[model samples]
Target chain A: MMEQSKEPLLEVRDLRVDFRVPGGYATAIRGVDLTVGRGEVVGLVGESGSGKSISMMALLRLLPAAARVSGIARFDGVDLLSLSPRELSHIRGGRIGMIFQDPLTAFNPVLTIGAQIVEALQLHDRNLSGKAAWTRAVELLAEVAIPEPGRRVHQYPHEFSGGMRQRAMIAMAISNRPQLLIADEPTTALDVTVQAQILELLQRLREELNIGMIMITHDLGVVAGIADRVMVMYSGRVIERGQVDDVFYASRHPYTRGLLAALPKLDGAREALVGIAGTPPSLINRPAGCAFRPRCSHAEAVCATAEPPLLRAGQLESACYVSDRLSGMTP
Target chain B: MLRYIFRRLIAVPLLLLGVATVAFFLSQTTRGDPLSAVVPERQMNNPEIVAAAKERWGLDKTLAERYVIYVSNLARGDLGTSFTTRRPVSADLAERLPATFELVLAAMTFATVVGVGLGVLSARYQNGPIDHFSRIFALLGSSLPVFWSGLILLYLLTVQLGWFPGPGRLSAHTPPPPPITGLYTLDSLLTGNIPVFLESLHRLMLPAIVLGWSVVGVITRLVRSSLLEVLGQDYIRTARAKGALEGRVMIHHALRNALIPTLTIIGFAFAYLITGAVLTEAVFSWPGIGSYAVSAARALDYPAIIGVTLLGSLAFLLANLATDIAYGLVNPKVKLQ
Candidate 1:
């Protein structure tokens, strides 16, 4: 058997997403550059308030009614922003699948899992008959390792256990077998064991299906386990980008360091885990200069003077003005 | 489901008892007495005649005793004699109910077909010109007085245009069909008299339309709003995502759930059709309960007034109860709750 070569399946470049606030417009995603090659997993890590989810939503043009997206979100050389509602609808579930965060709240409560999955299949492939659609739906459910797939397929979303519902969501997402799968906090609401199993299932599926993925999560541990590359976002801007190991072991950005330090090590080296102090800046009225400058301990006058742009730091991109200083090199 | 029925069954008798008690006292308390209408012109000022009338009708007894007698008579389907008509109240209701029912059925058919169709179409094409127009139409339909509308229709369609008959259930020249049932439409149909049936339809059409216009308006708005809300739900999005066609998603997924609220409105509208729109009945002089009740009031026929009022109230309550059961059946979530 010949080895398949890796190539970019999805690319988002210089993307900006803005929303009109009370008296002014607030940028939800500012000049984010990201890529997910075929058979690769890239995690988008940020806190609750960060625009990681917004960026993903923008890539799919799935933002709320108020959002205004610009720049390029290219999946297979086709710009998403330029597509009409009809064209976009074609790609949404047909080509690029999305799994929402909360499984319990994701699926329509009234519809049976089989019905939802079959609807997705029938939507894209009109040639597939009803019997064929149901058969394929059952196959997809079984592929997701749903025990008693035949019986469970007839059950509504609420009938299933939480983990089972999440699996059903995955089944629905992948029923069409799209080129790229966007899993947004797919296991955030589950127990630890279920989370591990789901992540494992996702990771295994990525390899087996060779479909690209953009996994968005707040936990760095999730990125470490599944992501080949990781991007760190803060206040609607990408702060750091690199290979997972480069970003994790040798983080050169101050915010990245603060985030890494905050992670509770599984080895229990510390009796109590430390957390990053101070709250995330509000998008409605952001402060001048670097958004993170107020929270940085090594802040100098220059740090607060102007907003630092995301620039290349060795092999990775770092937005800090003092990336060298954070890396222990004098400017 | 059985639990709901059991609850309603227990409530019916209690409600009927309350209605009976209120009717007995309200009649007693009212200024004019039933004997005032029953006594002949020659005996207008005779106390002996008034006392005889009261005793014959059993109205001279204490209120509680009158209620017991009323309840017992109602159990045996005896609604007492109509004080003004000198006919049995039950006979009057039996003669009149079928006519009203026919008119009501016609109105309901018109309302359901037009209102629900317009509503679904409006919601399906929300904010479009059709939706806007339907909304405006519903507003106008709801706001117009039924009696005024009926009068205008009579003038335009019957009096001037000569497109329909102005009033009554049949043409005077037609030998009144053998009166099997008082409802001319049914009797005409049973004897296979096409012209008579068609003529009866023509006479009833304007009144039904006038009465049903508000119902159509209400049902349309109810269906449109309910469908719109259902269309915007996440499951609808999920259905769309599943690649279900827009029509399928709407009809199969959104519409059925939306009908829960709509069914309630439908029940209320049906009840209104049965009891509301008194003005339209009077305008056309169709001899339905609306007109009957009015004449009964003017002539101080207490028994007839009480019977009509109780019947109307019963229809309203039963319609709502049926709506609840329907709502439960349509959505299992509602049933569980």
Candidate 2:
């Protein structure tokens, strides 16, 4: 799996998203590049306003009226952005399934879970009968490990608990057996126990279904176990990327280092977590140089004037010049 | 659900009592003494005759005493006699209410079909030519006065072009079709009286359009905004992400949810069309209860005014209840709450 897999299943290049706000255009996604090989798991890690979700949404052309997305998102050699909505409809839930955050509000309250699943199944395949769709929906629910799939499918979204609702959403997303499954903050709304369960369910589904996935989350702990590769994003740009273990053990960017330092360490002697000082820069009025320079502890004279592009360090990619300088410093 | 409805039902009588009390007091406060409306001005100066007329009609009683008498009569299902007509207000209401309902129902149909269609279209093509047209159209429709529209339409279409009859529920020659539903159009259709149905529709057209025009604006704007908002919901995006056809996404997902607020607007709009079409009815001379209420108001017929208001309040309440049930039906979360 670590071999340089050529011709990835999904490839995103130089994706940029801008929204028309009151004063002027606010750039949400500056420039992002991502690729997912067949049956591979790529975790996209970022803060709330880091454009992780927006960039993924732009892949399927799912942004709203006010948003303007410009990019090349190629799924199976087809450019998604070039396709019309009518043409894109074939690939949206058919080839690329998306599971959203907040499972409680994701599913339509009025529609039965079975109905929603069946509708998704039948949308792409007109030949599928209602009965067949219903049966398949139950099977999908069972595949997601939802209990009493037969009876529970008939109930509305509110009838299910948070974890069950998220599982039901997974069932709906995977009902069509999409080649690329994009789960956006899938377990963010659940309790710790339920979050683990949901993550396990997602992992199990990935193995059984063998579908390529792009997992978006802010929690580094979530990415540690599941992700094959991790992409660290800051101010709408990919700051660093590499194998998950390599990036986690040898973080290159200052922002990634700050993020890792802030997380509570559970192993060995406990150390005080180093808090990252500044908040994420506003997209409307981002600083000219490196977006994280204000918060970077080792920021020098050169860090403020010119932005540094992603550069190869030892194992992971680095977007800051001070990576070697930080590594040499004594604790 | 039954308990909920039963609780709402219990409030009905209490509400009716409040309405009746308000109507009674309002009639007393208004100008045009009932005696003066009934008797000629030449006979008004004669104090002896005025005293006799007051005694006969019980206008000599205090407001509280009159109210007690009105309530007692209402308990027995008797609406006291009209000051001008010398007939029970109940009989007049029964005769007049059907016309208002017919006109209002027709207007509601027109409003709903036009409004919902325009709304969905506007939302689908947001900021397009159709959206611009609908925005301007709704603005004009809502801003234009009902009586003004009614009069202009009546004058232009009826008096000038002669496309429809000027006024009245039916022509002078045609008697109302056999009273099956009390609605002439429905009764005519049921009885297979095409001529009567056509005539009734012809007379109803101008007034219905005028009354419904403003309501159409309300429903259209409500639906447009509601649909735009609902289309932006997570569920709607999910539906689209499911590769569902745009039409299915718009109607099945967005429209049904959007129609929740529009449904409430439609129900109250229907009630308002019936009860508040006083000027439209007058302008077109369509003899619905709206006209009856106006005449009652003009003639200072206290019992008649109170009866009309009481009936309007009842219809409005029922419409509101129906709307709530519909809201629950469209979105299950509401019923659960």
Candidate 3:
């Protein structure tokens, strides 16, 4: 399912973000390199505070003013970071769209769903008339499978249920036919059944539009179902990344293996789940060595000396020095 | 929405009745006889004159009978007779209400516009020079007594600079315009008397500003804090993510939400200003209801006092109703039904 030969839609290199704090600057995204090809869905999986969302937000310059971002984010041959605010705004919700985790909060409560969608449409296309935008907004809602698009269009966000609001949010996001869509935990706030439906809707939309997507979530199940490639982050850095099948089945990093081990199996007899010991390290004052060293059972003396770089092998990349020696062991 | 308004309207009379009962009893408890103001001093010893005066004003009846009579008269739209003015309280109020309305409306409009504008600017430029200046302005406006500010402004603008006309709604040389709405500015405008209109507006400036200053202070702080909170909302971020420029984001998304709370404050402030601009009215000699209320209190005019209190309560109730209706209109989540 991996499409390495396809031209990349978004290429980000050495993306770093530091937020101003009371004492000093805290490193949020230490260094992240990401690539999403056209018509592909790349899963960015990590625990909370792992910089999964911050890295994507930084590319769009959507972070708070206190955050200092330094990176090269090129989307469709345009260096996003270098673009002026005027130029960058054209790209935001125009060439690139974003969906937040909580749709209820993401939407303006006072504005009707249709008006919000029309706003997004008119922001990119100045010539779009209010009537035309309203018509298009209705069509977009119907396209997202919202019931009675005409009536739902006039309804407010609070009137919509969690699942329906997410659908409307997606409708607004894709109102301008964006080339790339960044869904930040789109289904995390939804119910299990609704999550499946939203995932299906996203998959269908991605295929029909041939849009590049970055799916940010902590749910492994979501990534396994829809993602072509996967990147696992820990403490503001990507520890492992590869094709979804390769990374899931033959996971190399100790943290990745621990994550796989933690997943509950439906086929096997009931058993207590194996959780990774200790929490992710704090980004403010991280230990000098590997962030996952204290939690890793296979930690060695060298692991305490320096953090290992991404050691790529074939279709997989893992930031672990002893992964080669542990290849034969099952998670 | 109509049903909601109707329901609110239904409660108005009952609420007014409560206000009337409270005002009537409170005024009745005061240590003064209504006849004292109505009859001459020598008549205090004259039994015939005293009895005639008590009988004419219905003061000869028992307290219960008097209350029943007062309530029955209130039901018939008579506010009884004022001891000081010797005219029906209702007639006195009718003549004075418009003047107070014009003054309070002008003050409220000024307060809302300037207060909300300054608030938005201050919040947009948080921690900047404008923010600091507005913060101090609000602090000073709230802390300074209206009478002190009114006097100071009167001395500076009228006595020192002679930039504006000294008191009253119109100049001493100008005759009153035809009383259409009983508001000089509006009445003059209706009659196409530009000079009277301009003169009335000029005379109105200092009093309105002094009366509105404290309300402006309240509304500014409310809007500033509210907008600051709204600016941090997820929907505001969503608005920005949609490529909305800063101006659009602030006005379209942030301001509307911020103004919801501010709207409630503004409505109550307007109600308060109507009867509370006593010092401003006295200083400027605008001949509004605030001064009427003060003189009524000084003479212990029960009918006039109760009538003013009833008007104040009615304003408060109506303001509350308006705020609720506005809330329902602005926030769809609030079910008007």
Candidate 4:
């Protein structure tokens, strides 16, 4: 059933991603559904093996050839999967931009930053002259607060430090004023200070440009700072979804609770941090029913026998049968 | 750059010394003799003529004495006299060197332009019909024996097709250009003789093509693989995500990164052009060093053999040196290290 309300800017429904292995097929992402309104920042939080990156890559149809993805990913009411490669390519950078995690490996070291940025502009607008294109590039670099934009424009990616490279990457991503920006763990590799600065820049750009974004991360702190709404994923499926405050303060899913409990407190308290037990299930041979039932403290016979659907739990929606376990309503 | 050249200059003489030592011993110990090839069997049977020949050529001295004289001559830029022509060996190589240089230069120019262009097109439309066609053509060039290909081209063009002449540098009827730099093309161009220049260029074209075709396959594969590797890097994806045209990504973002490895392949290929294409030159009778070296080895002309061997070794050394310098230029990591 569809929601009888204002249409969202991007809507993904019942998405399934499976891969062919040597023995048989293995499903990595199983029926994940989420949406983002225009100008909203949606955080996709999960541990390393939770398929957060794959789901984001799936939206762009950018996964490997072996990946078999099915379901609807509608962007501006256009089915992204249904478009031809040519149309998809035109949309890939012009409409929906992506910023990868590693800044060091994210740029071609030999080319000048100006040439790289100008090329991005020229791809869509063939009528622009080289001088105009270069001027636009310098302007974009300046927007990103890069010092001496004109002088730094001619410098190669290797000439800049890590933080500068990240900024240059940001300049390239937002140059075309894309509608949707996906930043996948963009600050995980940088130091704490640089990470905070990049997050701040991203939040500022999101507001100024009024663009929708899907920020993928395993850290709850990142989600806490910038996310308007949050989707907690476990083994490629959406386990919880709601407003960021409701999801963070009133988390119903055990995985979400575990992720929150695992976070180290910033306050100067000497309490021991509780770590999540059990390794993530391997994609090659996953368990039946609820994937996280074995690790859930409140799991029962019903939890292991039948997979729970994404149903209502207080203010948030979660895919856990024992959602009321912590509330003492069920035993 | 200075340090790189210094390292290369030091390495060159050591490489030459190793090559000279090998060439000298190999020439001495090989099946045939310079005496038999030059003196004739009848003249060699006469002891007085043989002794006189040995003394005059310094063959009567100990091996150590000959080596000392050999190194001293090398130091003085003297390559010694030829056993067959009874002329200074340097003069013979010098006469042939320009022709070889001219031919190699033409071949390299043709190969780089055609091969790299084809590679870019193929990679851009990868696995498409054009890519398939290009890959097949490149494979044919790569797998075909160069000597056989040369003969086939000769037969098809000269005998069957009747589109071109066979087995010569230029037309026999025309007067040879005034030896300005010993390269016919340059001399004719310098003298402003269009007809002579055209004639020389036309003849050079086929030999160059035959040699260059093999190089085309090598460089195309090199560029294709290198481009493919570079294309998969995060920077290329970032470039694409930034709305850079696919063409721009291929050329500006991908190709520069690709050139690093491709350059090393090209340098070695050029060095190989000198020694390995002997059959192609022999088939076409292009009068390059390849053909001359083959005969020099057969006749056991010690000086000619030594000179050609040393030059070939020097070519390899210089090629490697050039590759290192190019590597430093292309890769920031290399320069930093």
Candidate 5:
């Protein structure tokens, strides 16, 4: 089943990013180890300020000037963190594609969608120009299923509807045909029908292009529907990692269990949504033991005193003291 | 677009009417008669001569009748006659306008180029020494008086160093260029008189710097704040994420959006330069509308005073129209209402 010999497209180990604040530094991403093999979708789930986006942004070194990032992130056997800005830029849009949320603001209002896509393609490959770039842009727009690609390509961002804008952003992202795609909340701003369509488009692209993707979202339902593997984050740490079926059916972490329980059940009688009480801990002064101890209902003396490692329990791994008891909870 | 322009142009006459009525009433309502400066103090007792003088100047008519005559004459392009010089007000204004236009253009170009450069530098190096320098420079520009700066520039650059001629349009030795464009530089260039053009440009530099400094301050501060805000936007981040160079992100993504808000300031800045040119002209002895107004004000010349005010009002109206057009051009999202 596993493609054992081929290296993963992108592998990140012990990646840490610290943001210098007014006093000290706030560790936004702490020791996040993730690997995306070719043709696999890894859904990273976390609430707000959970470092889901930070970890992904760090892979490309896209944080602001004040951020201090550390650790090794290797892509195709090359160290990403050590690459010069010029070389890293080559790898950014050339080898990896990125799509962001809020496509309205993500697009430059002054330029046409086709122009932006052409710019993306040109930035990666300097030789293509004029008719060639224009044709490639039209092809990208058509790939995203936008109608009348030739006519619509000339319109500015304001002329596009929200769903159309997101589609255009997707076209821009996939313009270079990179091996890996990092989609950060790609469907958050979309309506239900549009969200489904975008998700379907993503699935179709993943299969046809055989591109590894890291989908960052807070929606567990989205993770369930499309993600091949799931990695749950809390504060600045990834607390659990497993196959989608393993994590969905036999969740081993209390935090993951809390997230799964909070979802509104569609199959049975509608029950009150179970929200995990307590807000996420501030990363500046992270909780001593486990970052989720304050919110975890199964917290014990060990859970409050010492942090647990993400050790393998057969087919899955979770950072918790009482993983055995939390593993068998029915959704 | 045509409708939008027509909507803006339609207000011009209404605004002119309001300005003229207010200017006439204000002159009448002031403490002394405008004719007092012209007539001798010893002739105050001669009621017959005074009534005759009033009739000649149309001052003997009722306020309503005088206003109607003023509007009708204005419509016909007659700006009346000056009380002191006994010349057509329109001719004098026409003679002086080119000087003011030349000064305003030079000052605007210098201020915008240098000030926007400083704003961009400060924003790029935010919280650094460049930012601090730009902030302090803006503070001095906005606060320092124009006449005071004009004198300081004169003392340092002209009087001390003896590098530039002190004030006026040209040296007494250089003959006036043929009046092709009215502006000395253009007229000199058109007439192929390089010496006159150089002298006119030389004399203009000091006052232009004096008038431009404050506007530079305003532009720098405006560009800095707006650029900083734009740099933080998600589009800028997206630009960087797309593997664009840092320079491309700043120029293509950030600066274009930041320029929209700055355009409004530029319109008002041009109007302010025209008004400030008055004080600057009075100090520098430049032969412009401003100096003409000052000399008229001293002599209580009602026609010249009214003419100057009308010119300024029109300049401002035109500037506002230009700003609206530029606003549309720079920002495609702004569909004129």
Candidate 6:
């Protein structure tokens, strides 16, 4: 396990979000606690509607008005949720940047690529002139490895290819030199080869700028190489968390083990791939205790009676009642 | 872009011709003698007078022959003389065209400015008091008939409170300014006649508001719904994430996309206003093409009816062309070619 000897750049504690639905409130994120040191990459892995993205969005207060978010997100010694909207706006793009899943939809169709980048730059820096911002935008585009930045900067979003648009999205995100970045499934919509390039670009940027990043994705392979720590979420709750290497090789939670087993191996004897048995429980009226009990192969009678709190065993923290017994077994 | 515009312009005459042909045949279907409009009721029994009047107006020709002659005359830019007015239909329409254009322009401007403003406000504060009030206002505007609303407003504002002019484009004694654009307000401004300009605007207020009320409802609903949809777009989230203030996020990112669909509705609304001004014009006694068309219809003046139909079709065709060009300009994905 990596030692946390230094002050964390971002520390989130007991983050919760509930959405107002037709009849009653649906708790999307029950309670999520995480910390990211400077220059560290944290991977949040979960299925769709698992509240992985919602937790990050809640930190930035980016969710719709229907969502009721309550959380303590401390960034650079400031409590983010307590700040006024005007004060929060400065921290949003100035200190903490975010890039979404779909770059094509993330960009305004009418505005040029350069204009969007310039907007981010100028929003944080009041004295920056338009011409200087444009020049800086082109430089940022080039920094993201986009070719012919001079000509491409003036073109509209629809004129660019999907990969190029994602590159531009990255360019805009990092334009302000934010200290922390939240990338929500950034490469999910990209091609396989393009995905590698984007991941590489993100790693290089994080290294050069020493910015802490939270990489959210559903694919286990996506986080295997990039993240320093891996957090596995199921049914809106974090089921397991540990150093990336330990979690991959010695995961304790049944859900995490199932996810790792579901990954297709490049070199192995041919065999049928295994998938988790059941779908996630509905949020409105979740099962009495463990939300994943129905899908868990190692579920016990105690799991249905009372929810298990996250218990630490050396380097890993797991929320399963049978995690201790399962730790002794092998694949 | 130029090529697209040129192609659209080329179709204008063909569309006008189609409207003209339909109007001609439809007028023929109405049970009426063309010569009765010109010859007096007493003179209708006199065979010599009726024959001479029929021959003079070419009503004596067979239907097919007259159609051929009508088409040829239309090709030469000649709308047949109106049997009721004893004047060329083109000349009469030319004189009234300016009045209708002025009124429609004023109403459209009013509707667009106020409607879009209300829509933006309503969307910005969804479920708020402002949103509720604007929605109720829109509902009433769309549901209430224009003539009834015009009369009510006229009585309340003009008769009860005496806050605005009753009706007409100007007071009874005011001589119209020199006809530069034939729009009283513009002409008065051009001639540096501020009093005349204010007087023309004063008289223009109530009728324009009454005419534009229904359109305002449509525009508000369209813009409100469109803006609400755009607010949920990914780009809007990106803008907000970029530290843009709520105002800047709305105006810079959301409004542009929201207004694209609204522009199409506005185009059709403008065209509708031109033709739909008939009832509004009657209430106000405004000397515009709509009232001219009404009078022509009553007299069964086929030539005048065809002329007005051509004008209405032209307005629709031009509005559609303008909308297409606007779409190309605002959305980069739209290829003009």
Which candidate gets the maximum DockQ versus the true structure? 6
Winner on DockQ between 4 and 6 is 6
lDDT of each: 0.82, 0.87, 0.90, 0.84, 0.87, 0.91
Write down the TM-score of model 4's second chain. Answer: 0.92
Task: List where candidate 5 sits over 4 angstroms from the true fold.
Answer: A1-5
- DockQ for the candidates, in order: 0.33, 0.70, 0.75, 0.51, 0.71, 0.82
* Global local distance difference test of model 1: 0.82
Candidate 2 residue spans exceeding 4 A from truth:
A1-6, A22-24, A268-271, A326-331, B29-32, B43-52, B60-64, B159-162
The alpha-carbon lDDT assigned to residue B322 of candidate 5 equals: 89
Which ten-residue region of model 2 chain B has the weakest summed lDDT? B328-337
What C-alpha lDDT, on a 0 to 100 scale, does residue B218 get in candidate 4?
Answer: 83
- Residue pairs with colliding backbones in model 1 are A119-B242, A120-B242, A123-B243
lDDT of each residue in B220-302, candidate 4, tens digit only: 88888889888888887777666555787798789988988889888898888877668778888878788878888787788
- Best-to-worst ranking by TM-score: 6, 3, 5, 2, 4, 1
Give per-residue CA lDDT, model 6, range B1-337, as digits (tens): 9999999899898888888888888889999877778888988899999889989988888988988999999999899898788888999988998888899999999899989999999999998998999898888888888889989999999999998987888888999999999999999999999999999988988888888887888899889999999999999999989899899998999999999999999999998778779989999999998999999888888899898888888899999999999999998889998
The residue-by-residue lDDT of candidate 3 on B1-337, one tens digit each, is: 8998999999998998888988888778888877778898977999999999888888888988988998999988888889998899999999999888989988988888889999999999999999999988888888999889889988998899998888888777899998999999999999999989999998887788888887888999899999999999999988888888889999999999998899899989988888998888888887888999999998888999999999999899999999999998898889889
Winner on lDDT (1 vs 3): 3
Cα deviation at A297, candidate 5, in Å, is 1.7
Taking the tens digit of each residue's C-alpha lDDT, what string does model 1 give over B123-146?
A: 988789999998888887899888
- Model 6 chain A scores worst on lDDT over the 10 consecutive residues at A1-10
Candidate of highest lDDT: 6
Please tell me which model should have the higher DockQ, number 1 or number 5. Answer: 5
Residue pairs with clashing backbones, model 6? none
User: Could you tell me which residue pairs clash in candidate 4?
Assistant: none
TM-score of 5: 0.96
lDDT of 3 by residue, A28-120 (tens): 998899999888999999989999999998998888899999989989888999998889889889989999999999999889999999999
> Model 3 chain B, poorest ten-residue lDDT window?
B26-35
Higher-scoring candidate on TM-score, 3 or 5: 3
| lDDT of candidate 5 over A181-232, digit per residue (tens) | 9999999999989999999999999999998999999999889889999999
Which candidate model has the greater lDDT, 3 or 4?
3
Query: Model 6 fnat?
Result: 0.79
